[model samples]
Target: MTSIPKTSRRDFLKLAAAAGGGLVLGFHWESAEAKIMNVIHGGTVAGSDISFNSYLSISPDDVITIFSPNPELGQNIKTSFPMIVAEELDADWTKVHVQQAMLDTKKYERQVTGGSGAIPHSWERLRKAGATARYMLMEAAAKRWSVPASSLTAEHGVVYHKESGRKATYGELATDASAIAVPADVKLKDKKDFKLIGTAVRNVDSKQMITGKPLYGLDFYREGMLFAMLQRPPAFGTKIKSVDAAAAKAMPGIVDVVTFKNNVAVVGKSTWQVNKARKALKVEYEPDGAAALESTTDHDQIFKKLLDSSDPNVVSVKRKDGDADAAFKTAAKVITKEYQCPFLSHSPLEPMNFFAHVRPDGVELVGPSQTPDMARNETAKLLNIPPEQITLELTRLGGGFGRRLKADYVLEAAELSSLIKAPVKVIWTREDDMTGGSYRPAVRYRFSAALDAKGNLVGYKLRGVGINAGNCTREDNFPSGAVDNLQIESIEHKSPITTGAWRAPITNFLAFAEQAFIDEVAMAAGKDPVAFRLDLLAKAKTTPVGAIKYDIDRMKGVIDLVVEKSQWGKKKGVSQGFSVYFSHRSYVAQVAEIEMKKGKPVLEKIHAAADCGVVVNISGANQQVRGGVTDGLGHALFGSLTFKDGAAEQKNFNNYRLIRMKEVPAIDVHFVNNGIDPTGLGEPALPPTGGAVANALFKALGKRLYNQPFTKQEELKGVSLGERL
Candidate 1:
């Protein structure tokens, strides 16, 4: 179980009279008797100055409203967080309503939601808040009945005294409960007593989403709001030379055309008008800086140069164990392999968009952002205002995948609003978004291993290189403490193109390379892949080299579950491959079944076993694992993002190939149930999918694919399997 920090009790209470005689619950955290009160008071309405400090409220009509503090980006945090509170409060789930909390740094210790950290960070805090409320309500009921609080029992928003057959709804006692002081220590429910925590509940806004209601950032609108579109530079590392806006200004509904640092903006009355004018606008760029970045071929040459050259300045040691040089010297067998993966785009369903209203006193912005507080601070710095002067709200995001972590879009909206001197909305077209270039940096990996005469592994080494996307190295990753005489080194090359996190980040490609190489080593030794990995895990459990961040027993549990569920070594007619990886504090194992269809590799089914501690929502957890498998397979089979002249070659879906509906396979997901605190599920399931599929393809076609997008253009044609064999 994860340990939670202890909070001290102090004078952190402040109550304001709420409209409609509702009861507000305000919680403050104290460390060593230093009190910091965070309070808010206002009506429950859209676009109102509601109190930011209040997280829960009870009205006179038996309604309980809970504010969810994390950002929702289709990972279902909005539903999961409130369920935690309801479980502790013993409130009726059906009578509870959820509201998205505005960005308030003081009110929430952390408002940013990325890396799948929200649930773990808020689990203990929210449970305490709910328990505190329930305690106050029980005290009020005991005072009214002239009985001890210990004799009262609260269940489903009602306090009952079985001895006297007396009961009162929480709403009926809201007025009296509001005056009671909060208790420093409250008893929390045991796991066996939970009713809503592990149950599957539909998303709170599912009805609104299906009915086409306004919920997403693109769906936001305001009266007198203008629409704007940007025409960014054609390539990276280049600035706009000149702009010809005469033809665009003559278009209907065009408002104004202005040039900014790297792009030109076209403001209009509606999105259609702005899009039309943007197409008509002409712009020239100075391409001298990006002259060397002509193609992916050039980037590959740079990577090869870095890989072959033994430049001490470029190489940085990430981790080392024992003496790899001595172990390799006496090895009987040595194997080496090189792997590469292309850049990728987030390509969320909804393109980047935000609405901003800048004024002399402050700036107000509403949009879908993973880091709302960071956006507020950056906008403040750009507008020359205090961070408190900027107000930011989070809407439902179509999808984040770590792309929304960057506040460039929010900053752009604020800057445009300040210039236009009115409320404005900035929208990015599909083409603009694809070419905007905060891409998942392409990476290269080289691996080497040594084995003794008995086929026992002795030494391992890995070197990686990438562009701008920090070192492509994770020291605490799997196979770290598992292997003795291990060394990991990384080199980063300079590139003007912007790069950022994508899905699992470095683990995405690293797992693919590492696991695939492990499979090759196992095959060379004539050993079962599943058994080989299990042996290593068992060895790590017994004698680990350093601090093992992952639990080897938990890792082995998921692997054993997957192997059993998948019926390993029992299939006679189909080819199958297995892989296991750990990341983001979660363990996942996957198996891919593949066969030939029309001379191309076709995935028939996928079996996955996930051990992410306790499953919050069974249905949502299943979908997350399923979606991750599909995403990983699609990218591994045919997804690639190339560059030409420092510009992305694939501008839209037409050029960028994604997995079609017909290509999806039946995915079977299973979870290992252990009552521990929940870990992240958003990214751990993705890293193993690629390696599983690649190993399956090797079994079917007798070919080893060194590069990603395993099915090349020539391979897509009708080629006989016998020829490759």
Candidate 2:
């Protein structure tokens, strides 16, 4: 195997060691995979220079720095991602610091840092890197002490020669250790041997967060950088016809006000000045799509129309099993429920911002985003430059929640600044960030379960409607023959809203709709949800659901863990809800305890269990689960995007709601401490929260909410979706 050239990563670490200060690896080259495996695992104070992918760096001082790829918003990735390296490197956990890696995709693949794929996907690789480094260090120690390397053991950033009882800090062996050959096929620590994987570690960036350091996109500024804010069209698809920048140009500190094809941008010395000047600019827009937009407010009627219209078009085939139509006709009982989940904005704490310095040779870009590689490609294309010329420096994001997945904002900022041949920081006001944001599509799910006379589930049919993300048309997804008969269909409801991946996999909304419906079906059959789920899982393994979008056994494992910890069947007084989901190579289970707090079903607590393969940092993993649950709470309790005349109605936080600390109950997270491997914590917990909360709400009212934002709106009729307990 061609090993990673030891030159790139180690070169920088050696320099940092010589300086005698904390070493920060701000990777920007793109992919660091070319580096050898052994260099990564060895503990050291010397950190190597990495492409965009490098997050964790060990100093000659043995201080480990993890440049967090994902934006923090509130999820504790700053701490969690580092925990993985700490686990593999066997470094002193307390010495770990999570900084921000720059946006360079070649360096870090999928560093977009959403969909809950980070820790899980990186688990094995990161640990292996750390282990490789450790092996080389052992060899160096053996040569110095005149003993075999096998006799030396590593623990807490020190290499110990067991024979002589001599120990050396990681820093002491940094130089000699670099000369050793990269160990081939190193031994990885088993799950049973993990000290950090199963235990909760404090977030490495917590102190910096609390101290209000210069973290997040908005905090990013540099010498001679201008601030630009756009005065976008009042409505979507409204193109700029003409602009008169005379008045705005007179405003003090205003650098330039230029009109692009779609909107007008006001560049000035500060964000405040540009924002103030933007409001005063004069521009004419030709409204395009607004004329075709529906003015009706009856979203319910629209949902009904999509549901009853029978058209079989497989826009994207996700899952299919048995002959659902045949089983439905012969079933003794047919229970159908229609549920609707509204559109939601990610609403990360720090609104989108990017700094770009456009030069004749190359350009520099900086910001927080989920898909860093995508951002690089998009930015490069917009600047009319090659990817190599555009440097994207990743910063600690305030939050991602899948919002940063699309890099339109990054492109817009860079494009505007590149045209002017100057350094500029594009700052999006909360309104633009919200209204102009890419939103989670409003979705409608129709689920029907057929049961035999003996109460054995025979068939299932699902009709789902949304933006399709795949196409304008919806399609069937239930796996073929997973049941005796299964029918899945989809329809398209066009919207101006742009859709991207949220917390879990592509079918997050559908998973919740299906799982929650299954719970209700179990109740109808007077059966335990777990028992019913197990029965389906058993059949699923033998004859599985629509397309096997989920793993039955892994789902069963997480469910069992949650059920055991939650005391599922015995839940009383307060309504208890349970749900399990599998997506993004991760399986997760969640149980939410709900009670009436002044009529609304307050999410009192959440018990979550996840089999993410391996636990890199137990505390960090738990933190992701905790944050994901709360994120789902927001989606369930109050996250929606409304449009009128082809423009988003919610302009800012006041109109678009978010779950605050007051609404956040203490979340309890537990990991399946098996040595299976690792997945991600960012999104798994989100998809399941909706299912769990909805099920609990079903028990409390004996009424099911078909749509999300379980809020009190005139739309839900008299039975408010968020009616108090």
Candidate 3:
């Protein structure tokens, strides 16, 4: 048995009253030297205190309840995190209950759920929590039986003295355990002894979701709550000039019409009524210098100008090693190509919506948010109230591809509720969500590579241009340290259109550009794509040039696994493309099989190999990988959010195409079996999907796609592939 580290004395466990008369336990990690204390104190338990920092509780009937601290945005953390605690506690899996914790930074540190960091950050702490509680329960049972603690063994929430044949249930000993002092140090179960950690446990909320239960933000409703809709500026960089709401206010079910800083608000009894009334309201906007902006023409000129500019101030060096210019000048052969991707919309199934009730005492917000603490703090600042006065309840999010990280929708609901002096639920229609700004920034990349006479890679240079958001290229991106002469430069182009993180952030475009260019280089060097990448991985593993952000061994691990699983070059009938990338501390490699159909590449299947460390829920992890692959394929095929005269051109799914079931292919996912701590699986699987598909298109059609949305409507109509090829 390996002993866990001892906590300091300042760390105390509080046993308080819980709802339904269960045992409520709260623990806090205040300092580095803090340890769980033994003192038991009694006081009137308030509703908030019942669950305040109360991660785990045992009921009188031996039922254990675990509170999940992180906000769940369909990542399955609610089920996975509880399994970590249950494994260490040796609790009965069937007897466990899971609940979502409120946003309280004091109790739960770093409650934000972005970057796929919840599992790694909470692994050790949660295991320690469960171990501490198990030790306390065993000690209490041993003391009552007048035996050495070593004689006791716990299994399935039962503490038994094997020698004396005396057994006590955890619920039966809860009262005594509450008074026992927490052990300074406790032992943790080894990986080989894990029962629930690696097991296939169903999602805690799966039943509720399948049964159409009210678990999402849009399902939330309160008595006497009014529905509100905002008639925002038609385009970016515009403000309200005048408003006319006479006919809107007179409409049936319409309550009132109000003007706000950016838009007009229509309040009514239902979402439909508010939307109907909002459509009837007449409003004029004052252009704010963005009315002349156009995505199709202006952005093309902007990117071209930036690429051709001689201003040194516009270009920033992100990474450099040796002399790239000299290597390129003296190279035996050089290959240069340019790639670009348009802006994208998240387009989550459930549009942005929130419910807020503001009063003199405090403000209560219930909705789906990726960053509840940030939303609460921002709302507090806007309302001129203390942060403590703002209460935020997180509901299950339909889908958050990094869009929910922004608290603008939450703040909007709070502001409207404050002005109306009533509980209000603000709903953003599909049009509002699609047309609203904060899209994924459009990016362009120019890649040049130099190779020696022996076909050995020597130099690589990349110059990237992104809109408004500075650089979309990472300094330590893949193949950075793999080459001796390498340079990465980025230029920023200002735009009025707001931009933000998409599913995988900059890696979404960066991986597509880098991997596609790598494939082209492999073709030019007369080497297999997989073999070429493996050679680079071996170089990075043995002799690296600079700081290596990724583990070379892990990179090789996934690539080899994917090559074997995909049967690269072994499949006789299908054309395949291979790609591997690292992001969010996880490595994923994908092989896409495609065939040309009506001059467009039709996906046949995608085989993936991932090394995200230990697998928590095999079923859920596979689902995530499949979903991510599908999302990446969908967007890469024909997804683009464009603008003309500062207004979004694609206002709905009809034009802004998403992958349908017919378009998605069967995905076979495999994971590396190792003892490494688990990394996030939500994002890493997505970045390589695009690259794999693009490479497969080239293999199938002998054409290189320099831009995204590789297949357009005209191309799909059996147009010749001669133009792009």
Each model's lDDT: 0.80, 0.69, 0.82
Off by over 4 Å in 3: 1-22, 29-52, 290-292, 595-601, 713-725
**Ten-residue region with minimum lDDT total, candidate 3:** 1-10
lDDT of 3 by residue, 517-582 (tens): 999999888899989988988888789999899888888999989999999999875889999999
Tell me the deviation in Å of residue 684 in model 2: 1.2
- Residue-pair clashes per prediction, in order, are 1, 82, 5
Global lDDT of model 2: 0.69
TM-score against truth, every candidate:
0.93, 0.87, 0.93
lDDT per residue for candidate 2 within 1-725, as digits (tens), equals 00111122345455454545432323222322213322432334434334336644455677665555555555565565666566767888766655555554555656656656556555566666667667767887899898988888889989997778898877677566756766556787766777776676665556556777666678887888899998877765567778888889999999998777576889999877888899888888776745444322545567678677745452333445656778888889999987777666767778888888878888877877767778888877776678888777677777776778788888878788877778888888889877777777667777899999989888777777665344321233223335767656666666555666665534557666777888888987889877888877787688544455565667778888998988886866788888887666777888888777566656677899998876666666677788778777776777778777667788887877777677787678777765676666666777788888878877776767566766643343465333222
Which sequence of candidate numbers ranks them by TM-score, best first? 3, 1, 2
Model 1 clashing residue pairs (backbone):
40-51
- In angstroms, the error of model 3 at 103 is 0.9
> Model 1: C-alpha RMSD to truth?
5.1
